[model samples]
Target: MSVMQGDGRLKSQRFRQAREGDWKRLERLMDKAEKGSARRLSDEEILAIPVLYRSTLSALSVARETSLDRALIGYLETLCARAYFFVYGSRSTLMGKLGAFFRRDWPMAVRALWRETFASGLLMLGGAIAAAVLVGQEPDWFYAFVPAEMASGRDPAASTETLRATLAGEDTSAGLSAFATFLFTHNARIAILAFALGFALCIPTGLLVLYNGATLGAFVTLFASRGLGVEVGGWLLIHGVTELFAVILAGAGGLRIGWAIAFPGDRDRLDAAADAGRTAATVIAGVVVMLFVAGLLEGFGRQLIESTPIRYAVAGTSALIWGLYFYGPRRRPAHV
Candidate 1:
């Protein structure tokens, strides 16, 4: 047994000695790559990486088979893993990544979620219709749908003049900047919740989305009943189009995750959910940007431009721009 052990040690030492130079070279290259110095590597060094990686991989396999020193095996394993990522992982800079996200990733993810987006919109519409009918029948339903804090005395109890004043930007007690900040924070919270709770089979996400629509409907019904339908329409649409669109997209993202978990088709449930998450994450990131723009419109444009016609024009232009950006046709990339 002692003689056999001695033979094994001798073989292991010879094996490591033969391949140690290649391993050290690969390690040096990996250090440069990891430190973001890959761009500075010589052309020959870049070409040598793969060759060294393959050699190290082969060494690892041999070490495992021959039962070489455990420490040597671990080192090779770590080196190979690092090399694999450097070779196959994303190499784009920060700006390049941002450009890719806006130009391709975000839009493509939104396109993929079309079915979910439609479903979410329909849910919101249904809730709105229901709330509108209830509020129209009895003003008390407005209290249930639109919280007091959100309504801020703009309910059925308020006079027509008061509501009209609010829409026409005549009510100036609340600073525009503060209002904008509040609106952004509120919308962002709802959007994030809708996405975060989607993993529970989409029930919570759907309900949250429905509730948001109900709030919108309740407010609209209150204003419309007071004979300020056209005025309120302009006021809301100025920022509502973008804000509501963002919420809908957020709901769609959550739905994607829920649907994947519930019905993974042939794939594993976890795997399907992961795939959906990647697409949903991309969409949610874009939704945040949309919400920011909506807040700006609500804060400045809605307050500065009190004319109903101009408000509608601004709303229409925003709608057109968003529609084109998300659903526009694109030329295919040329094959290399």
Candidate 2:
């Protein structure tokens, strides 16, 4: 063996003979090497120590009798040194942990499904606005966006007493179930289309979300003009704030992916697009979850609560949850 290997082996043997309680020799030897030499320990050296030592000896084991109980000391030193070099020592450990969460964590699962939530919410809002505008300007425009059934229900000719009877009663479980099921399926379909169509997804999604926004804008505007705006605003604001924001966020996520493919800087279009898709998906998942929560509030909370303050409370709470999950401090797991 070369002189350096000979010296290491000889010193290792000497270390084994030292009092087990005296770590001075081991410390001196480590200190004598380059200041950061631990960072450069070979992968082979690290792997071999673990394999050779197994359980009976520390990773720093040497075949020699020690007067001192240095075996444990040596083993600990070696193990820690290797860890400090390869695992926790690397700053990317935190990032790796985050990636794992996104892949395996429960919160990440909810986030993953958010895109769908936003898509459906936006579509509903858009259609509502477009129909409202048409109804206001042409009185016939409402027919284009409002399904025939909904229009028939809202018809002025319908008995005022009958309309009150329908709107005033306790919301039926059947109605809530139907709405929830519809929202879930509809939202998922929109999210998939948003992700799949790339940039092309933007136009349809945007139109949908915008149509909703306009419908809402018009709804409140008309109600206010008719002196019922305060009541209408109170009711819609309870959930509208959270639901609308979620839809916009989802639309932005879709656009983000689409633009990446359309204008991939330097990287091949496919690669750039793929990279964009990954980030967009991460962001979109958060949006979908927000929408789902919003839908629950809109479908159930809005229908059940006639009080304005209660409605705002629900809206505010939903918004708060969204802010906390996506933008709040990420709980980083401890590294092994």
Candidate 3:
């Protein structure tokens, strides 16, 4: 036989052997191929590998029987990496999760907020009212609710005068600005502490939030019955709506951490807490933004509006807007 014909036959035999996983023959062909001879696989080809416990076994079978199609395996790896990116990557995945949360998880968040607010805060209101009633029956008992220094500011007969003074000049722009700034910073720190304390367990943080709400309720009720209700309510509504809501949200976050520790659902306590923390952090991020806005309004707007009717109008509008946005419809399909 001619030398050229003999070489042709040798090449054909090598090709057949390579198809059967003859590594020696396959290596020879790889060496003979031109530089950069690797083929790219499509996305569909990559996704064809069933993602399961048996996936590695299946890929191995293909490799051993089919001359090790590295392209296919590479494709599968790429697909997996992409899936992981979508689920956990910092940017796209986080945005997607946020979208899902606003659309799907918002309702759950609202429900949690409502549950915590009423169930927890209501007790404080009741306690304050009971305290007030007792104080009426036993005049000396007023000291229990009002600290000595605060009592000087809590004269029952001074409500009208106090409100008028506040409207006139007591809570001037500079005073309001300083007070609002202090309150904002103080409250934010407390909220963070409440959330962080949940790591110790959930109950402590919950009690802290409840106690805070109770203090506010008692304080407000005292002013309300003193005839400063309209003025005090107006002042609070200007910024209290957002500030109080943030506090409630922080409590909910703590509850989430506590629930993870106490219940854990389908995961171990640590894992559950980590997952819950992610969601809670998202909620807190939103809350922090709101607190900043509230601080601005309280500092700037609260002092500008002097007329009671005008203050009430602004306060009422603010309350309504907050109510609708937070408890309003979820951003996405409820099923998700």
Highest lDDT scorer: 1
**lDDT per residue (tens digit) for residues 126-226 in model 3:** 55566666655654555555555434465444555663465432345677778668767877886787677777677777766756654555556666666
Candidate 1 lDDT tens digits, 6-95: 998999889989989999999999999889899999999999999999999999999999898898899999999999988788888899
lDDT: worst 10-residue window of model 1: 167-176
Q: Cα deviation of 126 in candidate 3 (Å)?
A: 4.0
Q: Over the stretch 1-336, how does candidate 2's per-residue lDDT look in tens digits?
A: 699767866776665456433333334434533365655656665454344334224434433243233555556557447444443345445889777655445354335436644554556565666656565665444444445543436443445454444433256978886775675555556555555555673566566555555555544444444445556665666656665665565665666566677778899988977876776676566656666766776667777887766766766786787667654667676799
Given candidate 3, what's the lDDT at residue 138? 56
Greater lDDT among 1 and 3 belongs to: 1
Candidate ordering by TM-score (highest first):
1, 3, 2
Segments of candidate 1 deviating more than 4 angstroms: 1-36, 42-45, 51-85, 170-174, 333-336
The positional error of residue 194 in candidate 3, measured at the CA in angstroms, is: 2.8
